[model samples]
Target: MKVPVKVDGRELTLSNLNKVLYPDYGFSKAEVIDYYTRVAPVLLPHLRGRPLTVKRYPNGVNGQFFFEKNTPEHTPAWVRRANLPAPGSTKNRERIDFAIVDDLPTLVYYANLAALELHVPQWRVDEDGEALKPDTLVFDLDPGAPATIVECCEVALMLREVLQVEGLTARPKTSGNKGMQLYADWDCREEPSVYAKRLAQFLEKERPKQIVSVMTKKARPGKVFIDWSQNNPAKTTVAPYSLRARELPTVSTPLTWEEVEGCERPEDLVFTAPDVLARVEKRGDLFGRA
Candidate 1:
């Protein structure tokens, strides 16, 4: 069944409103659409001008999922799109028209499709199709065996201290899963990937045992791997306030420096869809600076 929903005076057709997307929490598609609509005021800013790669789970969280880069042909004509050369490819070769979620209707349409996780590149596309310099740098702190988000927090604090020494401020957020991520806005002229790689190398050199910059699973035991590779122009991180495709509807929530230091475990920082909406109502966009 399909229903026409009006958002910001624009009409959109949403289907499967009653279909369960999170069996554990019994979260329906309608709830997901509503969540995105409520969070759009905060979420759209981060996504604006950035190309989105949606991870869709049409059969719900437990079913098969796929990543979509090109905007679907059936997408509404009113939705925005950015056509650019694929990252790392030669100019004028292999272009992809990526969906740009710049409005409430576009976001709601995605949510209705069970595109639970929204990922966006660090850089934005300009009107001339040139990729702008990334304004944010992300460090994905992935924990290894026997390690948890607590260890990631420890590493994040150390990273924050290091960044502060360089006159940069880092913000923390739960990965909506087992790890934590730290983001800092960059004002320099260097490319994001280059800067992140150099920073990761420096940190790994400073703390060889606790921090590993190499992207190898074998070297990750008992350490937190600083996934600096996510800074690449081709890469995307989970957008703030987006839902994770887990058994429960958990959100990627921003955190204060105090909360980062106070977290004893991952659960303490995990926020559900409702929790995130409430948080936005109270704290506003914690990542607004980034």
Candidate 2:
């Protein structure tokens, strides 16, 4: 069924409202759209002016999924886009017109497409669509099998101490999967990506058994891989408050430092769409405070 709705003065045609997108939780596409609409106030700020890469699960989370970097040709004219040079593009013509979900209408459009995972780089673009310096740095704490979010939490706390020593305040958020990520301000850092790499390496050396800095999958088992690569200009991390393509409708919800220190189990930090909405209503944007 298609429904015509006007939001923020824009007319949009939404479809597949009754289709179940998260079979495990019986969460439907309509619920996804509603989640994005209600969470727009907090989610939009993290997405505005950043090139978005969405993980689309058309048939549902149990079905196949694909990543979308280019804005669809049928994208509405009013929907904002940032024309960025393709990662390895040598020619001017090789560019991707990526969507920028800066408002409720655009957010709904992506949600309607089953774009459950919204990924963005740490940097934002200028009015001319030129990339700006990254405003934030992220440490993507991915736990290899045998390890869980509890292990990630231990590493996150360690990272928080190091960042504090650098006079930077680190914020925590769940990956909405099995791990967690830490974010901090990056303005004064000489090179955010380089610094992140060095920091990860340092941590790996300090706690050889608990952390792995390299991207080698073979070395990941039973350890937390500190993914510093997300700080690179070309890479992206899942946006806070965006849903993951998991069996359940899990959201990448932000956390308070106290929560990070107290997490003892993987399930302790997992949050669904309804959980996140309620969290925002009560505590507000914890990440924004950093």
Candidate 3:
């Protein structure tokens, strides 16, 4: 059943308010919508002008899920959408109309659809329909067995030092799961693909044993794969403050450099939905500059 609601002077129809989306935590669809509504002030800024890919978990976190690239045809007319050429498809000139979550109502609308995770590219769309230069460089640190987020944190510190030498400041965040991601806001004059590949090659050469620049799982055992590949124009990272479709409703949370260095275990930096909302009340947007 759908119910009419008003958010920031926008009228939206919210559905499945009582459905449990996080079984382990007994978190309902209403709670999810509420969380996004509360975090919109901080979250919407990161989402503004960027095409979003909604990862839907319609039947809850443990059920099957799929990614929706083109905005659904049923999207309300008031919701903003961006039409852009699909990335890396030379033959297909067809453009994808992506949903732009620029306000509280749009964010709530997706939440009601059980679109638990929102992902966006590092670059933003411009008035001429061209993608702007990437404003951030990201390193997705995925630790293999025997190496956990603790190991990722250790590597993140080293990665920070390397970035510092390049005159960049890095910010660390829990991947809302079993990894860590570090980002640096940059003003480079290079395409994201070129810059990311170059940095990946450089890091691989600098720490060949500790960091695997390649994407193969075979090479990842006991090492944190510095997934620099996500810096491409086509790729998207989990939006900061967005909820992860996990059993416990964890969030992709930003962290202080001090917290990153002090993390001895994954649990030290893990944050749930409520925890994230409270943190925002106290700390505001930690990734505001990025």
Candidate 4:
């Protein structure tokens, strides 16, 4: 069914309201849009002015999915677009027209298309649509098989201390899947990836049994891989508060350092859409300072 709605004075036509996006939980497409709309207050700040990459699951999580870097031709005229040089561009496609979801109307439009996951770079674009220097350093802690979010929590605490010595405060968030990520407000002077890689390597050396800094898959089993490569200007990590296109609608929810420290099970950090909304209502934006 097609439902015409006006969101923040922008007219939008939403469709497939009853279609189930998460079959296992019976979560519908309409519910997905509702979740984003309710969570948009805090979610917009992180997305505003940033180049967005949307992972669209048109046929639900069980079906095929595609990552959309370029805004579709049918994108609403009011939805802001950022024209920036494509990373590793081919001859025909030298630049990418990325959608900048700066407000509620734009966000609801994307959600209408079943764009479950929104990823953005560490840096925001200037008024001229030029990419700025990285302002945040991120470490994507991914656990290989036999390791889980519980293990990631232990490593996140270790990372927090090491970053504290550098006079930077690290913020923690679940990846909404099997991992977690820590982000720190960085000084824009130096390249963030260089520092992130160095820190990752240092931790890997100091805690060889628990951490793996390299990208090699063979070394990851029973260890949490500190994926420091996502700090690059071209790289994008999943936006906080955005839902993951998993079997269930899990959100990339922020956590208090206490929650990170106290986590003992994999499910302890796992938060679904409903859980996240409730947390937001109770605690507000946990990552607001970052």
- On a 0 to 100 scale, what is the lDDT of residue 118 in model 1? 97
- Evaluate residue 226 in candidate 2 and report its C-alpha lDDT on the 0 to 100 scale: 99
Full ranking by TM-score = 4, 2, 1, 3
Error in Å for residue 56 of model 4: 0.4
lDDT of 1 by residue, 159-245 (tens): 999888877899999889888888888886577777777888898999988989988999999899999999887889999888999
Number of residue pairs clashing in candidate 4, backbone atoms closer than 3 angstroms, sequence gap of 3 or more or interchain: 0
- How many residue pairs clash (N, CA or C atoms closer than 3 angstroms) in each of the candidate models, in the order given? 0, 0, 0, 0
Error of 4 at 208 (Å): 0.6
Q: Write the per-residue lDDT of candidate 3 for residues 1-290, one digit (tens) a residue.
A: 98998987888888889999999999999999999989998999889888899899999999999988887678889888788889654446478888888788889989989999999999887865567778888889899888899889888998888878878888888889889898888787666567666776787787777777788999889888888889877889998888998879999999988998898877898999999999999999998784
Candidate 3 RMSD to the correct structure: 1.9
Q: Comparing candidate 1 with candidate 4, which one achieves the higher lDDT?
A: 4
Assess each prediction's global lDDT (C-alpha) against the native.
0.87, 0.91, 0.86, 0.93
Please say which candidate is ahead in lDDT: 1 or 2: 2
| Model 3 regions more than 4 Å off | 88-93
User: Per-prediction TM-score, please?
Assistant: 0.95, 0.97, 0.94, 0.98
Highest lDDT: which candidate?
4
Query: What's the lDDT for residue 136 in model 3?
Result: 82
- Candidate 4, 157-234: lDDT as tens digits: 999999999998999999999999999998875678888999999999999999999999999999999999999787
Clashing pairs in 1: none
